[model samples]
Structures are given as C-alpha cells and as structure tokens.
Target: MRRDKIAVLVPEMEGKIRILLFWLVVMSAPAFSQQAPKIVSSADTASIRIGEQIRWTVAVEVDSAAQVIFPEGQTFSPLETVEAFMTDTTRKNDRLLLQKTYALTQFDSGGYILPTQRIEIDGKGFFTDSILVMVATVPVDTVNQKMYDIKPMMEVQASRWGWLKWVALGLLAVLLAGGAYYWFFLRKKPLSEEEAEALLPPYERAMKELKRLEQSRYLIQDEFKQYYTELTSIVRGYLEEEVHISALESTTGQLLEKIELLRDAGKLDLEDNTLRQFQNILETADLVKFAKSKPELRKAEEDRNKVEEIVQKTKEAIPEPTEEELLQQEEYRMAVAEQQRKRKIRFALGAAAGLLVVALVSAIGYFGFQTVKDYLIGNPSKNLLEGEWVSSSYGYPPVILETPEVLYRKEIELPPEAMGTIQDLDAFAYDDHRANLSIAAVSTVFTKTDEAPDYEGAVDQILAGFERNGARNIITKQEEFTTVSGIPGTKVFGRGNFKIPDSDEFLKGKYAILLFGGNGFMQQVVISWEEDDLYAEEIVDRILNTIEVKTVI
Candidate 1:
C-alpha cells in the first residue's frame, strides 16, 4: 500500500516539473536569439565569361564586444583569389556589421559550388549557404569571320652603338702601343765609355784627357794651334770642376787672378810654383789660338805634360772635406734622387690619366654623350628595349601585342553598380616602379546592352583614374587612330606630373591610351613612363605598332 502511494505522488511531481521547464525555455528564446550572430554570403554575379572576375562578399552582424573570425586562406577552391580587400565595418546601435570582399576568377569554363563558409562568433561557429556559379567561354564565330593573310616581316635597322666597340678597341690599342714605345725606346739607357770617363774625379779625368791628347795626331801632324786649344780646354774644365770657378768663361788673366784671390783667402792651399806653371800654359794657349801664334809641336807636348802636373799638384793641395760638409753633400744627393723618383711617378700617372681621357673622348665622339653615359652607368630602359619580348593576346575582344615581359593577369574590382552593367572585366598589367614605367591592357563586355561604350567618356574615366593615382597637371590631346588591320580607334595622349607615394617629389611623365569599342565590348591599351627615357619611348612605339584587336563582322 505504501509503495503504490509513493509511485502516484512521483508521477504528479514529474508532470509539474516538465511544465516548469517548458515555460522556462519559452521565456529564454528571445534572449538567446538576440545574442546569436547573423551571417550572410553573396557574389556580384552567378555567371561570368572565362578570365573574368567575380566579387565575393561575406557579412556578419554581431554584438560590438563579441569577437568574430572569418574563414581564411584559399578556402574557395576551384576558384582563385586574385585580391582580398579590407573588411568594411559599420555600427548599428549595439551591434557591428562586418563585410569582407574578395576578387575571384577562373581561367576555364565550368560550373562550381562556392562551399559554405564558417563564421566564428564569441567562440561559437555558424555557417552560410552554398552558392552556384557558371563560367562560359568567349564565343568566336569562325564560320562567318573573314580571314587575312599573315603580314610580311619588315627589316629592323641595327642600333647606332654597333661601331662604338670598334672605336673603344682602337683607343685601347693606341694606348698600349704608346706605352710600349715609351718603355723600350725613349727611356734612359746605360752610359757609354766616354760618358763613364766623364763621371771620374777631376784630377783623374784631366790626366786621362792629357794622355788621350798625346795619342792624337794633332801634334805629330804639326797642328800646333788645334793642339794648344784642345789642351787648354781640358785644363780649364778640370779647374772649373775642382776649384768651383768659372774658368772656361774667364780670360786667362781673370782665371789666374781668381786663383790668386783664392790662395790669399786661404781657401786654396796651392804652391806658388804650381800656380806659376798653370799660368804660363794658359797664356801660351790663349796666344796660339786668338793671336794666330803657332808654337812648336815639341812646345805643345811640354805644355800638355805641364797641364797634367798642375792638375795633380792642385788635387794634392786641396783640403779634405769636413764631416759636416760631407753630410750636407750626401743630403743634397739624396734630395736630388728623391725629386727624380717623384718626377718619374708623376709622369707615369699623367700618362695613364691622359690615356683614359682619350679613350672616353673617342667613345663619346662616336656614340654620343648620352649613349656613352647610359652604357657606362647601365640603363634599365635600354636593357628592356633590347631584350627579348613576349607576344600575346589578352581579353574578350582580344588585344594582340608584344611586351618586354609577359603581362600579369590582375583581378578587376568594381562597385555593385558597375558590376550590374559590366558582365566581364579582364585586366592585365606590368609595372616597373624603379623605372617609373607601366603598361596595361583592359577589356570589358557589357551585359546585353543596346548602347556601345562611349569613347569620350572612357577617355575621361582613364584620365580621372590617373589623377586618383597621384597624377596632377594633366595635359591631354586626342586623335583618330586606325590599326594595320583597318580597325579604327581613338588615341588620347599627354603629359602629367606624377607625385611619388609618401613624398613631395613629383616626376614628369607621358602617357598614351588607345580605346576601341564595338557592339557591347571595349578594349584599351595604356602606356606610361618617365618623359626623359628615350628607350622607353621607343618601346612604347613598338608596342603600339603591334597592337591589334579582333573585330566582329
């Protein structure tokens, strides 16, 4: 009886507890909904032409204080992410709306499902719905389109710098030849026998010359005057060297007077007999030569022997040099040797400098100053112009052209309004910031529009784009341009000052834009570079000449 009573009571208590829990969940539903995040995913289009961009966006609304994390990395497979934009945030009372956009594209025609993306809000994971996208190939009506013959190749003239190498080679050859000639032929040589004898001491030299004179036939042939003249010259040269007097320039009387003065001053320790004999010999030579007085051959020989004796006696009379005087003489000799060494070094340096200058001048004369400067310093523009190039076609209404390097495909980002009208946007570009050069090719297909792209409006938009990217002081000129294949287009070109990013410095630049519109598609080719780059200018011209668009018949 007691167990039955307890069971009945327990059933009544369980029923009451279930009702209470149900009411509690009902009351808390609104609060839980308010705290939960709201997530949404969308794309600019569900379909696109091959090589076109699709703008993918994801939005999540959460409490301002809650942390939200979006899917990262290459989460969207089968489709490539070309560019990821910054998240846009907006405040709605106590909640925040975060929007993240990405530019995606596919190179092949296919159908793909954009998988559901996970959004984390306050440590809880929520998901968005999957989306379907279709990519279609660009249609080409080959059956009705007319075919043209391939154009013949035109000859390209050789560069003007071809002869510069030869000129440089010639200059180098001249320098080498000149240096060899100087080293081998014009430099100092060893002394001969006569030169070596001339370097002997005054007394020895004088004695040697007297013996040589005796060996001569002048005395044997009775050439008395000549013999006396030769004999007196050797004596005078000896006196000048040994005594430091101007014996050769002085008269015989003046020469003897100088010697007497020296002896009186105690500078000369010569004996009276030696001086008297030298005086007699000098006076006799003067009379024989100037007065036409021919002395006997025997007398000439005696005079020569006396000259030898006088030189020997003079050398014996001379005082030995003091230590200080010897030191002074040694210093003077060393100083002279140093000066000669320095002179030789200077000469060598000057020769090398001159050779370099000559070579530079010769190169400049043949190749022009700018060419030489560019070659020596290295110009990127020149290298691009001369390097191998790539020829390729880009976009829907294909633009066929050549470039120094292949243009990289880039995703085009457009606003919602622009995406509504433009079905496909393909952009390919190359930029060399260091060279301040840019090249771009763009193509756009309108979504079944009745109107064509306005050429003038497009030109205005391009110019406006330049301004937005730091271009100022724009000057423009427009003209009609026709391709080699007879497709007509508008060309807009001008100069502008482009401000460098994060700096006040501005570089003057030139730009050219070619616009072609047909049916519902448009093609554009833009080229810009620093105004002073001649090589870039040439490259631009070459690219322009090769630009062609496929026309729909």
Candidate 2:
C-alpha cells in the first residue's frame, strides 16, 4: 500500500512543476516581444509673438509592465516656460498614454530651434524631435503719429521698508554695542558693607574706626607690628578727618615738618612736647615696618599708651563747630555732592553723543553721504542721479554712453530677411529682466541697400521691428536728437502694451529708440521699462545727455 501511494504522489508533484515552468515561459516571452516605448511631441502652434504664450504638449506611451516617467521643468531654453500642467493619464489598448503640456514664451523676436528633449521610459532615455518656433514682434502704427522721446526714468519710490530694514539693523547694532559696553565697562558691581558705609559726621566716623580697631586681637596675639600699625592709622585718620591734615599720606619725617609748619601757620595748636612725643611713636613704628627692627615689649606698650593720649589731647585742642558753622558745612557738602552728580551725568551724555556722531560719520564714509540722506529723506532717485557713472562702447559703431551700471554684451543673430542689407550685427543689453527694465543697442553694417538711411524710413523700420517683438498700440513722438558729443540722430518715444513672451497677456511699458547713421550702416539704441515707473524718465534724460554715438559705414 505504501509503494502504491508513493507512485501516485511522484506524478502529482511532476505535473505541478511542469505547470509552473509553462507560466514562466509565457511571462518571459512577452518581455522579448514587447516594442520600445513610443513618444510623440506636439505643439498647438509653431509660431508666437514675442511676449506671447504658446502651448507645447508631449505624449508618452508605455506598456502596462513599463513605468512612464515624464520630464518636469522648463526644458525649453531661449523660450521660457511660464506654466506647466500635470500629466494627463489614459489607457488605449494595452499601452498607457501619459501627456504633459507647457506654456512657453519668448521676449525676443527671432526664429529659435528647440533642441531635442529627452524622455525616459523604464530607465531608458528617448529624445523627441527638434522643433522650430518663430517669434514675431508686437505691431505698431508709425505712419500717422509723431514719435516721442523716451520718457524720463520713472521716479521709483524707494520702499521705506528697505530703509526701515537698514535703520532697524543700525539700531540693533547700536543696542548690541551699548549693551556690551555697559556689561564690560560702565555697569558697576554692587558695593560691599565696608564700601557702602553709612553717612556719618567726620569726627564720629574716625571715632568708630578707632573703637573697632581697639576691639581687634592684635594686642593680645602679641602682634606688635599690626597693633602699632592700627594705632597709628587711627591717629592719622582722626587728624585728616577732624583737623584737616594730610597726615594719612605723610611720611614720619614729612609729618614732623608739616606739624611745625601748621603750628607756625596757626592751623594747629598742639604743645611742642606733644608734637615731639607723636613724632617719636611714628618713627618707632616706621622702623618696625621698613627696617624689620624689633622693639622691646615695654617700649611698644608705651607707644600704644601714647597714641591714646595724643588722640584725646588733639581732639580737645580742635575747636568744636558752632551751630551756624555746622549748618554751613552741611550746605557746602551737599553742593559738592550735587556738582559731582551733575558732572557724571554730563560725562555720560557726552559719551553717548560721541558714539552717535561716530556712527553717523561711519555710515556716511562707508555707504556715501547721499545714501544716508536718501534714507533720512526717503528719496529713491538720488543714488542713480548722483551715483558713479560708467562709460563704454557697445555694439558695432559703438553707442558710447554712461550708465549707473556697465552694459553687458549680448550676442544676437539676424535672420536673412531682417538683415536685408545689414551685416556685422552687434548687440549689448543692460536688462536684468527680473526688474522689468531693458536697455539694448543694435548696430549693423548695411551691405545691400544704397538708399541713404532716411530719417522717417529709419524710424518706421525701428517701430516695425518693435512691433514684431510684441509691442502693440504704439503712441510715438519723434524729434531730432543730438548726443552728448553732438552725434545727430532721430529719437522716437512711445508707450505700448508689450505682449508677455510666449503668452497672450500684455504689460504696458515705455520705450525710447534712437536711430542714426546714413553712409552704409545704421545704429539703434532702445531703452524700455514699465510704464508705471515715473522715475525712469530722469534716467532716460540723464542717459541721453551723456550718450556719445559714433556711426561707421
């Protein structure tokens, strides 16, 4: 029975293994037979006006087993992508279709060939076909209207917040500096009791110190040196406090000399014997300290006793103040203390004012006087008007001008039609686009046209080119222009709606175009900025006055 059961189990196991192998073969077969992912890229329009928008769409197809990963970001260069939409997912047959769309625009009027964009499917890279896009200019009518000079630099109001930030920063710096100074220098440590003594009459204060010294154990400890030192200190302090003597700072010999002088001057009235006795005690104490001389215990005790007699006798000899005299002394002391307090206050104020003056001067020296003035007066145009101006040659037949900042050379290629009779094209721009201001110059040598560069024809050609680049509804006023160096040219000023590159939306801006040169080539300088910026008017005026144009055939 066991053998028969084993035989049936072997066939069952073999059949199960065979079925698993068959399914594996079926799954592997599709991996080999499946074709590579198919990608299709398309655009709603092949052409757009400068600053006008266009939709670019890309479709990606992948098998159900393969994951489709789409490109994300502004892959189109020269042409800017202003908007990106989420990929739309769909299923057709057994393949998955993933579609992504982008909104793109160009600020320049020209033909651009977008390079092949890479797409990835299942870890493999695939490229889309390169496409050509022609950007046209915004249209303007120059036949019937007078052209205007470029409006002045718009007086852009300096944002108070900008000044506020610097002000706040300066105040913070001052506060930090003051705090550190107080912490390290001006702030006083609290006084201990000895330094914070109570206000007492001079005699009483000297007496209190004497009593305190007597209570000390220097005598009992046989510390004769310290004992005599305290004894002499009490006498000298009493003389300085009650008798108006400089005895505390006097030498033993100096005190003897001052004593005799005081007696002669009637400033002191002690007996001659008392003076001799006091001198002997001071001399003996000085010997112990300076010469390390040891005195007999008997002599030291005699000196201690003499110290008391001298203090008492001297106290009695000093005349007591009358009630009126006490009042006058009090008033004098109060006046002196008040004067000291006022002096301290004046010193502190003077120091603070000095710091403030230093800070002001430093700000002027580092940031310029005009910058500080503008911050104080809230003037935004002062810096540009009074700032350092740089002069340079730009483009061929270089348009020499001075600007607050240097102009950057930008390379541009003219199409065969735009070139008509022009050659050797050069361009320079000072557009930091984020600011919405653009200044550019184009100089080209004409090789195909013999017609002298007519004033009206040149203005029309410039206006047409501006229109092609997305300027529309142009209102212009034209006048004969002379540069700073006296190069004659035609200046065209106008305001128009500039189509946002790659989008249909419009932004109103002011423009100034200068056209000159007649021998063989033409020179053009174009400046454009947002129309709402009134401060730009002055900038245009200042730039034109400083410009020196040179044209060559």
Candidate 3:
C-alpha cells in the first residue's frame, strides 16, 4: 500500500512543476516581443496652393491598441482644416491602424514642411514623417465703382445772457465793504520804534551787570558760597534775557535740575560734567552761605576763582549764537562754496564715464547679435541622422530623439545590479562636415525596493555633463538642431572637432557615433569625434537612414 501511494505522489508533483514553468515562459515572451509603434505620414499628394485646402493623413500602425495624440495649435490658412477624422475601425487582422486627417490652407504663397506628429501605442511612442505644403496667392478683381457728390451738414447757434447779474453784483459790493471794516477794526497795530527801544533797556542792562559780576574775584577769596551764588545768578540772568525764562530767581540746585530735565527733552547740549561742576560749586557755596561753615582759606579762594570761570563758561556754552556773530559768518560761506564746486566736478565725471560704457556695450552687443544671425541663416547644419535604418537587437524601451541637435543625452532606468557595472557609453555619426554625436550615462543606482525613485535628477546630471564637455561646439555647422525622441532625448550638433579632454590619442579622423540603451526601461545615444578616413561615408549613411522623429502631441 505504501509503495502505491508514493508512485501516485510523484506524478502529481511533476505535473505542478510543469505548470509553473509554462506560466513563466508565457510572461517573458511578451517582454521580448514588445516594440515601439510605427509612425508614418500618408498624404494624398505633397503640394497644395495657398487659399486652397489640402488633406493630409497620418497613419500609425501597432501590434496592439494605441492612443494617437495630434499636435497642438493645428491651423491651415493659407491652410485651414475644414474637417478632421480619427477612426480606429481601420484596424484589420492582428495590426492596429490609427489615422487622423487635417485640412490645411495658407493665404500667402510659400512652401513649408509640417512638424512631426507624435503617436502612442501600447504605452510606446513614435514620430511620423514631416509633410511639405505649398501655398499660392489668390487673384484680385479689376472692376472699379463710380463716385458721387453730396450736401454738407448744418451747424447750430448759441443764445446771449441778461440782467439779474447786475443785481447780484450790487449785493457783492455791499458785503465786501462790511468785511473790510471788520478786519481793520479787529487787527492790532505794530509797536513803534520808540516803544521797542524802551523795552530793550532792561535786558541790555541786566546782561552788562551779569558780566561785571562774573569779573569779580569774590570766590577766589575763600568766599565759596558767595562766588557760587553770583555765578548762578549771572547764568540765570543770561537765560532770562536770551530765552525769556526766570532762571535767576531759582536756587542753584533747582536750576541745575531744571537744566537736566531740558537736556532729557533734547533742549540742552551741555556735557554732564558742566552741570555737575555747577552743582558741586553751588552746594559747597550753600553750606558756606547758610550754615556759616568756613572752608579752608586756600580752598575757598580756589572755589571763588572757579565761580568766575563758571559764569563766563556757561554764558559761552549757550546753544544760540549772537546776532553780531551771525553777521561775521564768512568762513562757513567759503566752505560751502568749495563743497559745491567739488560736487559738480564729481557729477560731471560720473556722467561722462557712464555714457562711454553705454556706447562701448552697444557696439559689442550689435556685433555679437549680427554674428549669431549670420551663422543661423547662412550656414545652417543638416541633421546627421535623417533617413531609415534597422537595429540588430531591440532594447526594452526604444531610444527616442527629442531635438534635431547633434549631441544626444538620455537617461536610462535599470536594475541595481545592471546599473552598477555600466559607467558610460558613446555613439557617433560620420558625415562629410565632420558632424559628430556622443551621450554619456550618469544615472544613480538604488537597491531598496520599497518605493520608486525620481529619475529626473539622473537625467539632468547627464545633460549637465554633456554641456560641461563642450559638446555644443563639437558640431560647428549651424544646420545641427536639437530633437527629442518619443521617449526623452536631447540632441545638439554643429561643426568643428572636439578633443576628448586629457586624451593623447585624438578622435580626429572623421564622423563619430554614440548610441546607448539598457534592457531596463531607459536608454540614450550620442555620436561624436568621427574618424575622417575609416568608415566615414558608411557611418553617415547608416545614421541618416535609421533616424526617425517621434511626436507626443
């Protein structure tokens, strides 16, 4: 019984293994067979006249279903689209057919090639061929119309004014008379010269007396209290005359405190020590004056001398200058004149220098602009890869070109293990003009599987590297253009040779080709530094034949 059971279990286990292997093979088959959609242009005819409508059809064929996106802002005038038709029913058998019709018209006469169209099929994209359209002018009628004369338009007249104006004028005259009388009666008369002179005598006398008191040497004779008192009175008298304040009646302590209050209010400019010295002298004098205390004779004499000095110093320290001093201000006038002269000179020099710089910059800018314009118009470079070619091995995601320029840079996504070993790759295009192309891989690799990473940084890094390598001038011919692939691609080319930095062996011979792609979903191709002798003609032919434009919208 045990041997029979074992024989039956072996067959069951073998059957299960076979089923698992079959499923794996079926899943991997689709990955290998997947290809980018085929985009092609099918127009009834190539040429159409201006002001005449032309219908151009674009056909996209794919193995599976697809979404075809038309270009934005499509207009025909000189070519106008009368109608557009998009139909999916054209799909027959296993292939899918996607088509869009556009009626284009141009009012002016000229020839223009329509930009490439982008198509997406089964999540893959491709570009269709560019179509050229011709435009012609419309004829005008020769017949003229006869002219006729007509009558002129009439104008309207205005009416004159009359007499209540005089009555109103009379009332105005009476009101003016009353206003004058009231203003004259209310206004005060100005003081006469005699009265003004009488009022000034007391101020003049008080100042003279204060000066006489300041000259007295009472404080130098051991009379500290007397000296401080006299000094304070003189300062008070001067303030009273100059500022109309009754400072003379205030005590020394009271006066000093009031000055400090004024200083805090931004009304005084005296240093703290000036006020403190006044206060110290007054306080010492007060003790001598009121308490009958006699300080030492020598000290009292010094104090007395300081009192005279203080009185004179305080009078000189007042903020406002006397009228006579103002009249003698010739030095200040001379200094201001000197400053104005210097300022004018500086202004004139600065203006001249600025004008010179502006003129120089204008000349340089005009010449630079002319150089760029000439290069773009007269010496345009042709696309190195413009025709048809086939790939021996199809990569996972097909390489796409975004622009027509020569230098191509693209970022390719890959598994961590595969990304680690692939540092960079190169592509080349061989042409008679020494046109070359090259792209480098500078993407980062990650091992973690939890979340997907942004590949934009990796793409940007690769583009930056291309620019730093001076790829812009490698193809010197102006015909070189920038182009994008159905995926993401950047192409730039011109003319001239690019010396690979720090290399003893220069790629000086002829055309260069650089194409890179990965099994992982992203890839790039660039061609640069072509050899002049070896395979130059063949390389150029191969590149032009295989290149295709894929448009997204």
Clashes per prediction?
Answer: 0, 40, 85
- In the range 1-553, model 3's lDDT, one tens digit per residue, is 9999999999999999999999999999989776566666777766654335567787776675545566534443334444576554466576677777776654446787766666655455567777777665432222222322222333423222223445675687567545544444434557896666445644464455555655667645655666656655655666666544557777776777777776676555667777776677667767877887777766655654565555555555556766876766567767887886677557656665785578557756877754444323522223223322223211222232222333333444556765554443223222233344332222222333222322233334443555575433232111122233222233323234445555534454222222222222223343443545323345444544454322110
- What TM-scores do the predictions have? 0.50, 0.36, 0.23
Report per-prediction Cα RMSD to one decimal.
Answer: 20.6, 16.0, 28.9
Candidate 1 stretches with Cα past 4 Å from truth are 1-233, 239-296, 305-337, 348-383, 387-400, 405-413, 421-426, 431-436, 444-454, 469-475, 480-488, 496-509, 517-521, 530-534, 548-553
Best model number under lDDT: 1
lDDT per residue for candidate 2 within 1-553, as digits (tens), equals: 9999999999999999999999999989978878678889988898986556778888988887787666666578867666789889898888788899888776567899876888877788899988899998644312222323333434444457646777898999789768756754578868776765545665566567666766777767777788778778878877877777798899988878877887787666799889999999998888887777778877876776787778777777776678998999899999998997677677767777797899899999999986687667754444454455666777766667767667887867777786767667788878644445677777777675454554455567767877998887776655567776556677777688987766888889888888877566667888887776545667777788877655544
Selected candidate, larger lDDT, 1 vs 2: 1
Model 3 spans > 4 angstroms off: 1-24, 32-137, 148-231, 235-553
Give the clash total for candidate 3.
85
Q: How close is candidate 3 to the true structure, as a TM-score?
A: 0.23
What lDDT does candidate 2 reach at residue 146? 32
Tens-digit lDDT track of model 1 for 423-493? 99889999987777899999888886444665655677888889998898776655667787677777878
